[model samples]
Target: MVILTQACPIQRPFGSHLYKRRRDFQLLDKRSWSLKPLIPRVSEDQDTDYQLRAVAKLLADEMTANGQVIGIGTGVAVNEYLREISERLGDGRLSGVRCIPSSDVSASEAAFLGVPLTTIEDVNGNVDLMVDVADELDLENLAYIVGRGDNGPQANQPSLPRVRQLLEKARVRVVVVDIAKTGRRLGGSVPVLIEANEDIWEDIAEELDDIFIGDAEIRRRSVNPDAGPRGGNSPVITTDGNMVLDVQFLEGLKLFGKDEIYDRIVAEIETVDGVLEHGLVVGVARKAVVGTVVVSAIGEDGQEEVKEESGPRVVHL
Candidate 1:
């Protein structure tokens, strides 16, 4: 009975002209590719907060029903969704809706929001739904990249393996992001968290560089720890004491068509000597709720005028 329904009509999304839903999609077909140049766009805009709130509200409605046990992910978009769910629970509109947060930050935030919390083990891995956010998303496929952009180690990142396991355990998985985050191809580096013999990490990085089109740099912690790391030589360590290697693609891997390099990497990257996990999430999200931006029109004064309205679209994956 858990289904995604739009509470309101969504404004035409930014990339409607570029992306269309098709049942059968090919990864390497140039004819099937609508791949645009991956330009750097800001996910945070003037209307972003509004759009996020709207997306949060849309998901909260159905997620609250049937006493569902939800799996929450990290980042600001997921935080907003948590806020919406929390408010509904507080007002007595929702009950028996427990949550399993992906990271410590989400867990603390959920506690602060007065939403009851549970674990995957506590629920015996029977999560009704998993809701998360993405850094960049391929609208053509449900594939996405999570985690902050190659910024050493994310303070809020839980065990990457655990996060992946939770996503796999869920009955349904949904990713919510700003429309700006969607594109023809996903950009950014793929983080490889490794736990191996100290001497072999350099060899692994060298091997990764040979396989991919970019450098695979081992991440370092912030030297100052207050104003962000300007330059540091110390390797950034994970909570689990694993080392992180961020494989930054200089030009992007879309030249060979969608998911070519990415799929190959995802399948074989772990086979590398030291890799524990990587951040290239492929086709995991079954649905997405994307927040639209404010539409604009030319005014009488020959100036662009921003409209007050924007909405969220429930995209089938």
Candidate 2:
């Protein structure tokens, strides 16, 4: 069996807290009362690199078997994290752990580093843990969005679906991310990537009156002399072997309500023929382990004063 493992360096210890507080309530009846605000606090401090290192350690510490397989998703950010993990594992910090990467890019990187690779078929009855970063996560943690890179379609391919299936089989799914990616609302910071079939791409773009095509851009894995237009002239590609249409919203579109907005758009798009997959991820992560770092400076009196600097936190699965 092939073993996949990676290592990353850590500069400090990081942690996050999740708290829920009930607000004051007035009793109107014996069985009913008007409750006030319920607050949920999530706090973390760490840079993108630091959070990735911390996540590697967390995964290594939590993994039970030496020869067990772990799944990693693709992206520039995820690749950095994997590089750190692979480095640490190379130094003997972690042993006998194999990796199953989410994309061709990730698979190539893993193979280059001498890490063993496996497919869903290779580990037919074994447990595989996938750790990936998300573009957005909502308050209830029910909805998530990913595939911000130009390779949305490939990113969602058998890798994502297969990981979801494996996680469901294991009865648990863990997501690792920095705190900045977590918020009460979704899509405010990151734009959603939607994949539509070539046949219905034009029709769907026309039907979604709320969605506007932002720009025409090329979707290439890397720069190639044989490739088509480098910038605006190139065509977009989806992972499912279909064309992609970039959809945007006007400044004042009616997207106030989350459920209503998602329902309306998803329902409309699904009804259209030849729609392969949309970028809406509902109920993605069951649990998130966020990592934050605290930096301390030495004071004049030779004492240390701790200060928090924010960048990104790692969400662990």
Q: Identify the candidate with maximal TM-score.
A: 1
- Write down the lDDT of every candidate, Cα atoms only: 0.58, 0.42
Task: Report clashes for each candidate as comma-separated counts.
Answer: 0, 26
**Clashes in candidate 2: how many?**
26
Number of the top-ranking candidate, with lDDT as the measure: 1
TM-score of each prediction? 0.69, 0.56
Candidate 2 Cα misplacement greater than 4 A, ranges: 1-47, 84-96, 125-127, 150-171, 188-199, 209-233, 249-268, 284-317
Worst 10 residues of 2 by lDDT: 31-40
Mark the regions of model 1 whose C-alpha exceeds 4 Å error after superposition. Answer: 1-46, 149-153, 213-232, 254-261, 284-317
Tens-place lDDT per residue, model 2, 118-230, is: 76667774544555555555534435555544345444433344434444433223444444556654553222233533344444444332222221121222223245322
